[model samples]
Target: MHTNLSSLNAAIAGKTEAEALAVLADLFPGEVVFSTSLGYEDQVITDLIYLNNINVKVFTLDTGRLFNETYLTLQKTNNRYDTKIQVYYPQTAAVEQLVSEKGPLSFYDSLENRKECCFIRKVEPLNRALKGAKIWVTGIRAEQSGNRQDMPQLEWDEAHQLFKFHPILHWSFDKVKEYVKVNNVPYNPLHDRGFVSIGCGPCTRAIREGEDFRAGRWWWEDESKKECGLHAK
Candidate 1:
């Protein structure tokens, strides 16, 4: 489907999260999909879609390296909403080959190795999850990373061949947390202990008091190389 980014943004302008999601679901029906990582922002989106009963398919990529808390949050969300959020996983053969050839922890050796692992675990599965979708919704916030600062609320993703929308793109961290709290959404408990970004457990950690929002992810790498290719340009 051909989408005009400017017109799409204008259509959802100033609408509440649920309202905007309802509009998208009505417009695309089964063609709109939302990907969540069980983070705070994602919990808010889950609430918007599930609680409001929007006609959007929700799914998560299970990389097998996720935190225990993430799994628990996923379970809690499913029970609370009475919805089964679909799961997409990396192909078994690709994962076997990568681990067999490079060994676990090879991602620490170089940026190339890291991106390769991410491609096997995240990017590839993301492509599968996004198949046949006309729109891909995400929980990205501009303030979370410099890479996303220039992203608009609506944009065409050439790699995925769909329009990607960030419902809370301009929202603040505090605003997201407050929404989660007020809505009684289930979120990863790691956020309470300084883990600003929750990805695969091995590559993620809690940040210090004055650290950047994304510092907790791939902490050893240069700040510019931290993205895992799932959201890269």
Candidate 2:
């Protein structure tokens, strides 16, 4: 069913995010999957999928270092939708080896060490979760980061050999917040505390006034680009 990217893009062209999501669900049925982080942006996408009654399977990666508030939001979202968003975890053996060799807080030491830890914890689990998925849904927005500003709403993910759809790629942060509030969607309260991008607890912090959107995550690394391997090309 996924033999042509042009057809898929045309099918979703000019449609609203929810409408496009429904189109993908109809096109691929069980092959469409969504990854959620329970943040404001993701919570809005969650509402869109659940309310629209889309048949997309939604899941999240647990890096074993996420904030407690994020866990609470996950539970609230599950209860609200009566749908069990799947949970994927890092492999135990790999985690043990990495921790034993580099210690638990090795991600703070250097950019290489951080990316290695991210690969073992977040990226590896994501790969497993998306094993047979044909389309991967996300909450990525252009205004969130500089690199994402030019991204299209729907595009092919060459690395994973699947379609990556950011339903709200062009939506503003205020729009996301408004949708979450209007729909009564469950979201991580950390966003209210200036923590724009929530990931691992120790690796994240609240940003200050006039700071960049991703300023909170990995603030220590000045020379390296501030990103985990999750969304890297």
Candidate 3:
């Protein structure tokens, strides 16, 4: 709950991804953590952490509703990096209660139901993953969504009680793909099939060309209500 954003920002100022991660490791030590979705940008950060040997705990949420390709990429990444990225699963009791009470496809019925499902499967587990961490690193890029455009590269997340860092906040989609290709980072194959932002298997779809990056996610909902509460400030 104690972070001097200015001093930490100055420490990482003008540093490469590896250097910035090293700085965070020095600042927070074993308390630094990163959550990866096995996407293009996350893969780049994974490479930076593993290749540079940064002491950061990496984890991913298994929502019990993910694409096969995502799992494949997760395995490939583990193989490539020779590391076992920790996996956090939703609490079984909560998931059982939700499904038993509302049925399996209740999320498609209304926004409230969708949010509840997301809370059970993602937000709650994310809170558990972030517990006792001083730094919560992510691969959020500003160009990915309108809501994220105004977010700083590093900022305090009051809800999570941690300093959130976006290492490639200013990177473009092409640049992310370039880094992945050049570094040989393992990424979800769904990206090549037009799935710009991959998420739950039932909730995500491929977007047509000229569409917003987030359009593929929660496509049934209005654009303003697309967030799943995991990234909601």
Candidate 4:
């Protein structure tokens, strides 16, 4: 229940983004981890980690249904950074059971089905990746969505039993793109095509102008708040 982030915030105050991450890396040693989705924001974080040689573990969850552009981005990121980002996959048995029982496209059937697929493909794999990690780094920017607008730069993740540090939480989306461009970081090309939040190919689409950022994801559902359980509170 200890959630005071002031001390941690002050620790990184006046430091550069990579420097702040380096501070956390030093503070937690091998317990610091960052999860990337190969998006613009995450690409920027990956640049900072690899470009700066920060001592934090970087990994991604392969949901077995991601866009080809996503995998291409991962490859380009690895080549650009000269480091291989660790990948975690859903347990084989669980994926087999789900696919054999409900078929591959069952997530479109109902919210429950979608959530089940998300849990099996993303949430569970993420849980396994974050096991024993002390600090969970993320590329969460406040401007991305209304729900994330009030997120603190650093906070305790009760569910993960660790601290979640959003190094660029207050950064604007434009700033994120600028960072990626300036650093020459490799990113998913789908972002240029209007895919704001890239996930599984079948569940995601490119959003048009004036649409909400979350609209492109799970467009069929009537629910305004569409999530795949990765950031569920």
Scored against the true structure, residue 4 in model 1 reaches a CA lDDT of: 80
lDDT (Cα, 0-100) at 208 in candidate 4: 96
Q: Give lDDT tens digits, candidate 3, residues 90-144.
A: 9999999999999999999999999999999999999999999999999999988
lDDT of 2 by residue, 80-190 (tens): 999899999999999999999989999988889999998999999999999999999999999987777789888888899998999999999899888888878888999
lDDT of each: 0.90, 0.90, 0.92, 0.89
Clashes in model 4: which pairs?
none
Evaluation by TM-score, superior candidate among 3 and 4 = 3
lDDT of 3: 0.92
Model 2 residue runs over 4 Å out of place are none
Off by over 4 Å in 3: none
Worst 10 residues of 2 by lDDT: 223-232
C-alpha lDDT (0 to 100) for residue 153 of candidate 3: 92
Query: Per-residue lDDT for 1-233 in model 4, tens only?
Result: 22357777788888988999998888889989999999888988998898788999999999999999999999998888788899999999999999999999999999999999999999999999999998999988887788887888888888888989889988888998898888777889999999998989999999999998778989999755488777743
Q: Measure candidate 4: CA RMSD.
A: 2.0
Cα lDDT of candidate 1 equals: 0.90
For candidate 1, the per-residue lDDT at 20 reads 84
